[model samples]
Target chain A: MCGIVGLLVKKPELREQLGALMVPMLVEMAARGPESAGMAVFTAALPEGQRKYSLHAPVWDYDWGGFEGEFIKRFGPEAQLGVQGNHAILTCDEPADAVKPWVRGHFPMLHILAAGRVMDIYKDTGHPASVAERYRFGSFSGTHLVGHTRMATESAVTPDRAHPFTAGEDFCLVHNGTISNPYMIRRKLEHRGIVFETDNDTEAACRYLEWRMREGDNLETALGKGFEELDGFYTFLIGTQNKLALVRDAFACKPAVVAETDDYVAIASEFRSLAHLPGVDQAKLFEPMPEEIYSWTV
Target chain B: MDGVNATDRRRVFDLSTARVRDLNQFLHHELPGSGVEQVEVQHPGGRHAIAVGINHPVNVEVKGHGGYYLAGMNKLASVTVHGNVGWGVAENMMSGTVRVKGFASESAGATGHGGTLIIEGDASLRCGISMKGIDIVVGGDIGNYSAFMAQAGHLLVCGDAGHALGDSLYEAVIYVRGRIKSLGADAQEEEMTDADRAKVAELLARAGFGYQPSEFKRVASAKKLYHWNADANQEY
Candidate 1:
């Protein structure tokens, strides 16, 4: 059991309050998933010709004094790095494919959470309220965001096991149920030279989508392929740079509610997570049918 | 406002200050007689177990939406929600009536023993799962796996039903006016008799639904799954 929440602000003015509006929704989900909480925010695009990469370490006491000099020496002088809590965001003119491998070789302790133009991922193993406060999430400004509170049904209670798992480039996914055939699917993807970070089933699902998209499938087509291959009771909220999509398994065993209004489109595991959204009282509320993909974009 | 009479004084409970426990405590404090016969609950959204375990005959009107197990183990109390409801709206209810003016989530009346549950809008998955002896009426559609493992009761769906209706059903009777996508293990559609039509008509009228009894179909257990045999194991 887990809680997933996604918000796509239709009005640009509400972007700054995205995190503020999301706090109550995340906190309400504490009952569903008390083990860990995570979020992915899609803010304004990166500066021209620059790419942003989010990195996560176990502790905030990691050395950062020589980080800028090291990055400059490896890549170029156009690199900029900043540390907030246990997360670090690095912006550079180099491509992600070039910087990612070099960063991994230099910083063995750091795990790349997300590397994209508009996405920044933050997560930790703690209560949702405390984690949100620690990261000062209320001040975050973004066009859209996706969050997850994990109950840790199968994986260890580690920060890396937390959700909003990044798929490819700017895509991320948060899942609620388990996949029964993940090992078989993982082997199949591995045979296709697709690398995996964690043994989490959700990661396999995300990577499967990434592989499909890499083979020239759009988000909708990739998801349609997933419906045919994936087996289990699952409700997924996937986030791209411009779109947020929701899909439930054919059984629809997992719960999901969608509320749409003039200002925003919100999706959550239950209505309580969406009860406080603006204009929610007048919003159109309905349960997403099984195997149907519901998506909204900027 | 509508059900209140001259003898019964209505008391308003603001959930902002008084929690759901307080509301239940106020109702259960007096066993046989809680002079307050009518309760008006305000700001009821995001709260669970609003008026559970009520023994006395009272009327509760929730002004807004409700959370899980809104009226579990209720007895002799008529609970009404003006807005939508979360999962298990009247789970294991013993008696009285629970009505929702809006939609209801999964497991609306799960394992209810005896009572009347009415949902004016659609009900999500598992509307009457494992029901023992209750009467549930849904004015709109219901999702998959409804009436699963039901032992005894009556479920009346006015609209379409999703996949796997009455899976592993035992003794419970189901009347669906719209399409049934599928039936679960050991459950089969039976010919509706005159008595079944009368029962369906009465339940629909009681729930304030206008539908012809002739349009409905009855579903019951085939009694083929009560015993196990090695030859029947192939069917498994």
Candidate 2:
């Protein structure tokens, strides 16, 4: 089990304050998932350039220098490189539609996690506090953010196994349960040449959403498809730079609570995580209905 | 309150002083509305009524792993637990129901004045101890001394019962099938008549257990202990 949280704030000023507020909530849920923690922030873009999708993955065993040279040759000079441990972040200025096909065609061992302008994903092994420290996120600033604290159970415990996983550049997801049908769905996505990073089931969930989006389905529709296709227990929150969505499995085995207001929306694995939110009311305690899919756009 | 009381998170509360001070404080403490939703207690380490006396039409879900007297004295709330509950779950409950999806510790549904208590799994010793006007239906086997001293209402067990069932019972009818190791003082096995079979069948259906009433036997106190006769040196 893991702790997942997401908030869509109406005030842009709250963007920077989001990280500070999230730190306490994530820390309190340390018992739920103790392996790793990461947060993705989405802020409004000032430049309004073409949509960009970026995937950061740690390449292992292979020659790092040779891989970097080959990656630069494949994507050319537009690619920006940053290294963290064995991980590397490759980004480009091209539109997501133009960049995704090229990345899939070149990297046979990579999985795309998020596809959108202003997309950010951070993950590392250890507690949420340590992971946040690794990113030097003294204060996270974003209009909307999704955070995940992962406990490795069904999947191997590694930095790559962390949540807020992205598929292509426009879609990103964080999950709190197991996906029983991951291998089957992975095979299908592999047929489409979507590379995978970790052996985690969430990789299939990411690819599943990408598969639906590529087929011209909207985010909500793809989430609905996930309920029908993905098996096992899951209460997940998926976010892009422009959209936020919630999905519970048909059985609703895992727990997820939502507190909504006209000004903002917040969701978490437990109501206690939302207890410290400014306007929480005990009267609105409700669990998401089983098989229910909720979404919002900004 | 942000969540359950910080002090109560690790402290143990017993049946007499059982209180759920901040039951829904985590879920709806900041929202506006009266809509019913489910709240779960991840680890109920000997805490009572994580949801007791809730005034709203809510569904309180305790994900098992709980302690004594869960859902005790509940009113206007429906509680469903996913695991085994401790002694006296739904005790003194009024105007609402308590459903146990798994086994019960002991004395479940004790002295409940109203509402139905359904135990889908087996019940421990002293099951439904001193039940008064509550309708208790157990799907699986019940341990020894079930329905002992029950004053009123029905105690029905769908599976076999252990020793000394319905010891010194009065008013309440004890229905069980299969073997009984022994009977409590003033309690005895009776004939399984049609009326007894029908009553047991109805309770089984309501408790979501399908059973053949003919496979059960009726047990009740002989009422010899209800009054004192000064005639001989014998006391029933």
Candidate 3:
């Protein structure tokens, strides 16, 4: 079992308190999933010529200064790295296709969690509260965020196996239920020269939706095809640069409750996760219907 | 606030300060002759299993939304939630009445043996799933797959019923006032007889509704999927 929490603040001023509000929501779900926790936050878009890549070092004390110096020397002075323990955001003026390969060759041990102008990903295998503290998730500021706490039902427990799986750019997805046909979707995507990161079923779903969007389908169209091709029970919460979408399986076996106020839209596996939110007493709360896509724009 | 207070006969519990376990313990602590007969839970904050497993004839009034299993296995207690409720409220209730002033999530009265659960607002999927003798009355629509495999009970939906209503039914009777999206396997809609109208009127009166009984249509088991069809291809 896994717990999923998503929050999208409607007012721009509340963006600064996004993590502060979401920290409690994520922590409350620790009982649902205590093995690992992760979150993907969407900030304001960077300058048009800039792109940021979330890099996770192999060790907590990895020499980010040396890595930053080497990157500046190779990619020119336009490269800047913002360090945060083992994770850092490398912002460069170069394109992703050009910079990604160079980073992989020079720093092969570093894992790239995400790449986009607006999104930053953080995940680790630990208790939700500890993981949030390790990454200082409470200080994060963004327009919206999607978080997950995983229990590792089918996959092995590792940092790389954590959720909020990113596919292409700012797109990320978290799942609660298992997919019965991950290899089938993988094989289908592999035929089209799509590479996979892990054997995790959520990754297959994540990459498939990214592939669909890359092939000129909008998020809605891709999800419609997903409902037909993807065979499993899933309550998927997806994150993008501008929107956060949620959908449940046909049976509605898994639980999901949504609370929307004039200022924000919050979703969780249960109501307690959102009970402490500000103005929640007056918020309109409802359960998402089966097989229905509910998306909120930033 | 005046009637329910810090007294032997009436009590108040603020879940923000007090523990839910404590409240439940009080309900079961020699409840037969205990003078504690009324409870008011304030600031529930969506806690689970509040006021559950009661055997006394007490009155519980929850002021806010409730989480899962608000009052399960209740006997002779009349529980009322002024706000919404989460999943499986009043599940397996033995006797007495449970009422919700707001909406309810999935599996409201699942597997309840005996009781009357009234929802003033809509109820999500599987409202009365596998109900033995409990009667559920919803003031608004019910989601899909409601009353699946219900053995014996009366489910009254004042609003529409979603897809596959009463799939794989046994002996439960469903009364829908609004449209039924679809009926489940071996579950067919029948003409409402005078007895059915009287039942609806009785339940509606119990729920304090003003809707006319003639508006409801009866749905019951067709008994087709009951016996084994050895020669049939089970294509369904």
Evaluate every candidate with DockQ and list the scores: 0.56, 0.04, 0.79
Local accuracy by lDDT, each model: 0.89, 0.71, 0.92
**Candidate 1 ranges with C-alpha deviation above 4 Å:** B1-8, B30-32
Weakest lDDT window of 10 consecutive positions for candidate 3 chain A: A95-104
lDDT of 3: 0.92
Better of 1 and 2 by DockQ: 1
Q: In terms of TM-score, which candidate is strongest?
A: 3
**For every candidate structure, what is the RMSD over all alpha carbons to the true structure, in angstroms?**
2.4, 15.3, 2.0
lDDT of 1 at A188: 98
Give the fraction of reference interface contacts each candidate recovers.
Answer: 0.44, 0.00, 0.67
Residue A174 displacement (Å), model 3: 1.1
Error of 3 at B154 (Å): 0.8
The list of candidate 3 runs beyond 4 A from truth reads B1-6
Off by over 4 Å in 2: A46-92, A95-115, A136-138, A282-284, B1-236
TM-score (C-alpha, index-matched) for candidate 1: 0.95
Ranking by lDDT: 3, 1, 2
Per-residue lDDT of candidate 3, residues A169-214 (tens digit) = 9999999999989999999999999888788999999999999999
Q: Where's the lowest-lDDT run of ten residues in candidate 2 chain B? A: B9-18
